[model samples]
Target: MSAPTATARRSRTRWFALGAVAVAGAAFVAISVSGIGDNLVYYWGPKELRAAGDKAVGATIRLGGQVAPGSIKPGDGVSNLEFDVTDGTALVHVVATGVPPQLFRDRIGVVVEGTMTRGGTFEGHRLLVSHDNKYRAPADKNVDIKTLMRSTAGLEER
Candidate 1:
């Protein structure tokens, strides 16, 4: 081929490669934007969810609340147990038929990870025990307040 024609062909190939790269990049961006909503997580309170009306149907969610006072009914002779948890303003009835930790009790702080059923009941997948402010350290029962505060920063003043 002539010198000028050979150089022109090489330049054309470079531009073609650049165009291919740009198209691939745009396709990747479009796919990422389209899938954004699918990865979103929704946090719900018992009251806010109940108020959602028909929108709450078949949606996966996480609910936070305290175990209702005197509502925990441990199994009579089986692992199955029933309880009610409240978010102070809203209450949700939970049915957990598994072995419960000793910390599980009425009026204690608790979190249940579950999904809401069509019948309005929560089926727990895992149970969490909440702690109170009065936690005592078993290692050092005799540590004075002043020393303990000095050891752990930000806690001494409180």
Candidate 2:
């Protein structure tokens, strides 16, 4: 029998430290993956929702589409709203409760977050309006810049 040398002890210590670090890293990755999976909310459009069939029911998902031109209607409650969201191919009826955003209107793109009911209606709790970033000149383009500047010039010093 013989006692271990100083070099042997240092090598063993290094291996042990390396193993601990690997275990910690694995644990962190596992935790992060699980957290992300739990928080994930799948987004579906009208066509996708139709394709989902039974799977879409009872699942909390996000639906994105444009509000149908003539489908906005008052629901059973004051704040309740019913509208058809369409992606030009399919339409899904959405019933939402809460204050609709100012930009929420017919023909505007929207994304609603909620669960779909068994009766084929989406019960939404949150509403998001989508608008394009295209910029255009105003229709009334005859404004005189010098006159406008003169009007505000007196107030600029204040």
Candidate 3:
């Protein structure tokens, strides 16, 4: 064939470049979506957990709810804890082996990450305490703000 025209070569080059860019963009999106899917942790309350039934067995999930009143118990090990998490509608038994955070207590919100067992108990590997966003005034009746500010002024001067 005769030598290709400059315009024809430029046209082919532009199409090839566009195709490469499109392929790169598609690959980037595919990778990003897959990564997000693998790392996403769906939070489930007691009712949702119960509704999940057998489908949730052995799947890692985040259980979010309040620790049931009077359900906290000492587990087999020193750091192990057993409690029931409830959302007022349903409850799930949780067995966690770790150092519980200082805020962890019954009647308080918590999110536990672990897998649900076939027996319907959550085998928690991590524990997170959830606190309300509302702020409350301190109840120290004897301490005056002026006196406290005066005491801290010396430290600030230094």
Candidate 4:
């Protein structure tokens, strides 16, 4: 092939510069994301939360565990809820507002986020139920209409 024209060379050079910038930007993003884990926490179990003790007060935390059996209670205000999260080793009492998801029930896996009060209670503002990604249709005979409707009475929001 014949040598590239001057215009062609300039166009190629511009493309190379753009590629280099894109690569640099990608590398920078990768490095920044890699270091983020050290500064942020995803979740902590009840035992770990309790262990934090005095340090936990007023700290934004995501506490994860199963809902303790017999601990769900309605608070004084309407829509206020109280419950306990347990890892079978320790438990943290949680006071939250807003509706819980349909899957929320006794012994169900959950993640609650908020700050710990000075009284050793977690004041949760958000609640999440841990669920598998896969979806399956329930058998006609296995599903209970009454129970299902009760469980899904209020959809979780906020």
The most accurate candidate by lDDT is 3
Which lDDT tens digits does candidate 2 get at residues 92-141? 99999887889777777688999888898999999887664433356757
Q: lDDT by residue for model 4 over 1-158, one digit each (tens)?
A: 34568778889999999999999999999778778655666787788888889898887889888788789997776467999988777889999888889878886668899999989889999999875333346866665543433211111210
Candidate 1 weakest lDDT stretch, 10 residues: 149-158
* Better by lDDT, candidate 2 or 1: 2
Q: What are the TM-scores, per candidate, against the unseen true structure?
A: 0.52, 0.60, 0.61, 0.60
The digit string of per-residue lDDT tens for model 3 on 1-158 reads 34578778989999999999999999999878768644454578788889989988887888888788789998777566999988777999999989888977767778889999998889999998876443335896765543332221212232
- lDDT, each prediction: 0.66, 0.76, 0.77, 0.77
Scored by lDDT, model 3 comes in at 0.77
Off by over 4 Å in 1: 1-43, 76-78, 136-158
Q: Residue-pair clashes per candidate, as listed?
A: 0, 0, 0, 0
Off by over 4 Å in 3: 1-41, 140-158
Candidate order by lDDT, decreasing, is: 3, 4, 2, 1
Candidate 1 structure quality by residue, lDDT tens digits, 5-57 = 99999999999999999999988887778785345533455676578656765
Alpha-carbon RMSD, candidate 4: 7.2
Give the worst 10-residue stretch by lDDT in candidate 3: 149-158
Pairs with backbone N, CA or C atoms under 3 Å apart (clashes), candidate 4: none
